[model samples]
Target: MAQGENGSIHENTGERSPAGQEAAQDTSLAPRRRKPWFLLVALVLVAAIVVLIARKPKDTQSSATAGPQIATIKAATAHLGDIGYYVDALGTVTPVATVNLYSQVNGTVTDVHYTEGQMVHRGDPLIDIDPRPYEAQLEEAEGTLQHDRSVLAQAEMDLARYEKAVTLQAIAQQTYDDQKLAVEQYRGTVRNDIGQVQAAQVQLSYCHLTSPINGRIGLRLIDRGNTVFSGASNPLVIITQLQPVTVVFDVAEDNLGQVRDQILHRKALPVDAFDRSQETKLASGKLLTLDNQIDTSTGTVRFRAQFDNNDLTLYPNQFVNARLLVKTLKNAVLVPSAAVQRNGTQAFVYVVTGNTVKIQAVTELTTEGDVSAVTGIDAGTVVPVTGFDKLQSGSTVTIQSMQAFDSGQQRLERTQDKSGSTL
Candidate 1:
């Protein structure tokens, strides 16, 4: 050991005093302790900065994906063609003529000339009644007529003799006049008897029941051997004409002017009948006549259309839907009715171009089936029919399908069948 300045003791190597050595150790420890803490703090700051940087991109991506999505829709193109204007109405099929047959004389039904539901022509015998009593009455009238006629002849002969006697001055003028008056009275009696014979003949002919119209017979109300009377409430059978059947339909009174104009200008306007679904066409006919008065309660007018029901597609009292074609618009701008949307009273459509839609105003003239005759939009313009709810004035759109609308009824019917809806 050695002694140094300030009385500090040193080790055998003469290195330094205890105070200097402690000071050096303290300085080195300070640097080591500060280095670990500074490194830990720097690492924490770096982790925070890296986390912020990663989160910024995630947030930006979330915002970008959260924007409004494009809407998908179906569209159709407008067509330039003809569209028929028609008036629709509910109708009932009626027979051209209906007749109920009843016996005109009281007698037993001896024979039935035809089967039930058989077709018969006018004056065709339907039922044969026992005419024995009527024949007897006719014979008695004939006998009385013969007796009266003989008496008249005898009286005429006597009058002739009296007339000659008067001319010769062998008889008084008063007596001759009486003989002439007697002859006249006998002649009048003969005429009366002849009239009675004719009446009896008519009564005898009534014993045979015949059809008054050409038609199909209904169920027989009276059977053979059953008694029938002229004044009976029940008829023997009912006959209805099937061919050339008539359809009675009621049209809205507001459309009466158009229908009347067409009828006046074009005779026998075309009419069509359809089934309950209004898809199946049953028959075709022509406008026959209109009722004398309109039904005030329903604001409608009854019109009759006649059809040549050669195929018997129409039946008496059958219910059907009628459509009368009044006019046809040529070179009309037509579009699908589904594409038209009403904003209050104004009609509008979404015209799509380049994946974007623009609201367009259009004038709708008339709608028939799934088509609408419109004005404003030109033919060949694309119109969106679906996705209207997700759209605005300038919304983006993705067309799922684009179809061509036919002005003809073929495509219209096909669409109806697919959707099972009216439009």
Candidate 2:
């Protein structure tokens, strides 16, 4: 029985050892069950890829969806009417009628009918000379004229009587002849007295000085108490007509033929006068006349333009810039001056094509204000105005709506306001 118990114990111990050994084997295999370095590395790489994908630049994919980055202008058809070829020149404003007021007779100035710088009409009395002496002279002239008239009547009657006496021989022939001679002498004397009287009367009428033309009187050189004389070198006052004024300017000889042709064809050429600043237009007028001949020394021609100065804004001797409209052109192509780009003396423009910009050479004809007349660029072509500094031929542009572009930002804001207002 003891031997049996020993065998049972050995079996039990062996069973326990097998179970423990199995547990030990399981524990050792647990360390060996860990994943390989390559598998871990693959899992880490997959995780890194996912994170990188999530952190990638979002704008890159949506960049193409962003609208064009260029500013554009819609080309419109325009009727180019009367494109004038103008000649620019300097000019001076002058009065159409200028006169120097003077006294016609020697006398003391008694009354001044007009104030300084006063507007006077034609035949208006401006200066009234002392009339007392003139009145006495007129009275004396009248009496002398009356006496001459009575003497002339008596001489005619005597001549008729002498002719009758000579024909009838009622008196001595010598006596009749002497009587006729006496009548002739009396007639000559009477005619002389009449002329003297008329002269005196004309001298009396010259006491009053009147305006020769309708004009504005300048400052009076002679006061009311001053003495003035007829045919004096200096005038009593100077007067100028400001209502109808004249502007005189010079044009080159080359343009003379054009001006003359325009005058003959159109009857009148249009002229515009601007002040010194060239910003303010003073008046518009028609070409009235030209000098008889061109100035040989300067190879230029002088011209005069007449303006109706109803407003009286133009003053005499004021300098001005003048433009003469010689002719006009029709169906002209014009673009903004800013759209033209210059490379040396060659002129070019940026034209918008399908997904690209092109640089095209153009011929510039003339410029008026901010617009230029050009050829080669059609009216429908889109010419760049603002981005010329950053643009080149064939450059891709993000075409932005001109209405939506902000010049300050040089960009277009895409977001609408919270109020749903389009910016």
Candidate 3:
């Protein structure tokens, strides 16, 4: 054992101790080894963090210097116009008069004068029955009437003679009175015969059937040589008037008062008839009359309108849609119906005032199609018609497309109409 330079005791033997060898190895290896890069990496990171923090404030200040973003939207203007109030109802086209021709006398049909579905005038001969039977009966009645008239003349001559005889007192008064009474009885028989002759003539005329009115005749029911009886259950033919046609429609009882007032004032309400789809207009007419009572089951009243169907556009029992122009609104303020938004039953519009839009509550009078007649805003007020997604009470909007809003509202009604969740 030997003393080392410091105070530690070390063995100086050729085979050194394990602790001494480890200490010498550490001292020699300390200078030759590489230095760590951790400190340099840590300083570079600190500089990068400082640069990021310094740039973030400048970007934030620039964003804060700029004003709020203004949104782009579409807008429309309100205008004044005349809006018509119309009532629509399903209807059926009907003829004013339909005549069903039946046989009045029993006879074999001799001739059919009119063709099937032909237009016939009043008094036009239509069918002919076997008149020989009725003609012979009429002749027999006339012969009997002539014979009774001759007997009455002879009795009257005899009564004159009897009157002269009674005045002169040449014959008994009882005998003259008997002759006068016989002459009076013959006169009564002659008067009865005259009535019989007139009745027989009427029976003969019935054999020739004539059209009672001018109209389009239907198909023939009975052919020639067919025997027809009197008072048939079915008609021989039907004739319907086509020139003046009518349409029957039902109106709701709730609207009865408005309709009744217009009718009582003698105002002819114009009615337009459309096809089954209620698209193509078939004809135009005026309201003729209405039923005195309403139908209790349907809560509606029947109304009839008459049209001059010169083109034969209207037919009996044809289905149609009738629209009646009840009244007209004059100088009504109107806007696009889309502009009107509803929150439940409350209707509102976004009225643009200068750069910002304010929520404006409005009263909707009526809506016809795409336009609405509103009361809250003025006629020239501007409103945003689209872009309701981000709209609020005070939304700044840029109008991209401005339109002249026309008035015609329908679905969005007189009450509250047309709503959305986005307001």
Scored by lDDT, the top model is: 1
As for model 2, its CA RMSD to the true structure in angstroms is: 16.4
Order the candidate numbers by TM-score, best to worst: 1, 3, 2
Task: Note the residue pairs that clash in candidate 2.
Answer: 68-398, 68-399, 69-398, 69-399, 70-398, 70-399, 70-400
Number of the top TM-score candidate? 1
Q: Cα deviation in Å at residue 5, candidate 1? A: 62
Q: Each candidate's TM vs. the true structure?
A: 0.79, 0.70, 0.73
lDDT agreement of model 1 with the native: 0.87
* Per-residue alpha-carbon lDDT of candidate 3 for residues 280-336, written as tens digits (9 for 90 to 100): 567778999999998999999999999888778889899999988788788999888
Q: Candidate 3: count the clashes.
A: 7
Residue 28 of model 3 has an lDDT of 92
lDDT of 2 at 156: 77
Estimate, for each residue in 1-423, the C-alpha lDDT of model 1 and write its tens digit.
234643453343477768888998998898788889899999999999999999999999998989767999999999888877888999999998998777788999999988888999999998889999999999999999999999999988888998899999999999999888988999899999999999999999988878888889998778899998888989888999998899999999999998888778866688888899998878777899999899989999999999888788899999999988788888998899999999999999999989889989999988877889999999889999888999988889999998666784555456446644332
Question: What is candidate 2's lDDT per residue for 63-142, written digit by digit as tens?
Answer: 76784455434322222323446788899998988997667888898988888889999999888888788788778877
Q: Which parts of model 2 have CA positions greater than 4 angstroms off?
A: 1-82, 172-185, 230-232, 341-348, 355-363, 391-423
Kindly provide the TM-score of model 3 when superposed on the true structure, using C-alpha atoms. 0.73
Kindly report which residue pairs in candidate 1 clash with one another: none
Score residue 103 of candidate 2 by CA lDDT.
Answer: 73
Error of 1 at 258 (Å): 0.6
lDDT of 3 at 139: 92
